[model samples]
Target: MTTETKPLALTVNGRPVGPVDVPEGLMMQDFLHEYLNLTGSRMGCGQGICHACTVIVEGEGGALREMRTCITGAHWFAGRTVVTVEGHARHDAKGEIVLSPVQQAFIEHFAFQCGYCTPGFVTGATVLIDRLKRKPVARAELEQVVTEALDKHICRCTGYVRYHTAVRDLILATPGLVSG
Candidate 1:
């Protein structure tokens, strides 16, 4: 008896990659880590609760949402665009990588201890930032908004204060992230 494999073709990290065949029931985490060597999204709880396997998926409407890759099948992402932690950086004209503001914030605030959950936190923060950009939040409601955006992820090292602070700081530092 052999496990069946299915074809997956999707855009990842701003690059078109793969019409690769992955085994049926193969989690996107495994596909990312094993096949693509993208080890940022970790399998913390293996359940969606931890959200250590979060990745951003751009829907047809251009709305980006965080998805748990640990339980998602590779085939589910077929034809969709996904951005992992590696995709969050920008490149300068000289071809140098510039870290995204969220990534820079995390580093500035010392947001992670073991760093196992940083990727998920970063992804979630990026989504929240993007959302806020489209529909700016009020300064008064920023804390609640940040809490709601990041509540799903679990970080054993920093007690989440650092991550929360990092995100809040990022928002505050960026002009027009919130209008109040």
Candidate 2:
């Protein structure tokens, strides 16, 4: 006798994504990378130490929260909406590729070196920027905010300074982003 599979529904990259029957024990990272081909979220430590598998879950009231997809099960994502680096660009009114301000800032600041940890940083930073939009962080608060947003990412090449600077610069470049 064959057992029936369960369907999971989630939104990805701003689109209605799935009712795919993922196995009961499938990890979110595997479902994302292997099956869905949304590979921007890397599998660095696989145990969630590296934070390279970060993705933004769309929360209520337009909030975006960063989550480690590696240690999470596919079931955890059911009925949730997730955003990856792949969703950073969208067509503007003129049909041109418009990169989100966070993504543009990352490029302008030269935020990455080996490029492995960039996606996670970008994802986390984007969520933090959204959260801080109303409060407007000060220069002193900048470091703390950045540290909290990027505490999980582990980069051996660019080091934390550049990444911290990049996130700070992004917040500074955009008014009303960081808090005091």
Which numbered prediction scores highest in TM-score against the true structure?
1
Pick the lDDT winner: 1
Model 2 weakest 10-residue run by lDDT: 1-10
lDDT of 1 by residue, 40-106 (tens): 8888998778999999999867878999999998888889999999899999999998999999999
lDDT per residue (tens digit) for residues 64-93 in model 2: 888898899888999999998888879989
On a 0 to 100 scale, what is the lDDT of residue 9 in model 2? 85
Clashing pairs in 2: 136-178, 136-179, 137-178, 137-179, 137-180, 138-179
- Per candidate, the number of residue pairs that clash is 0, 6
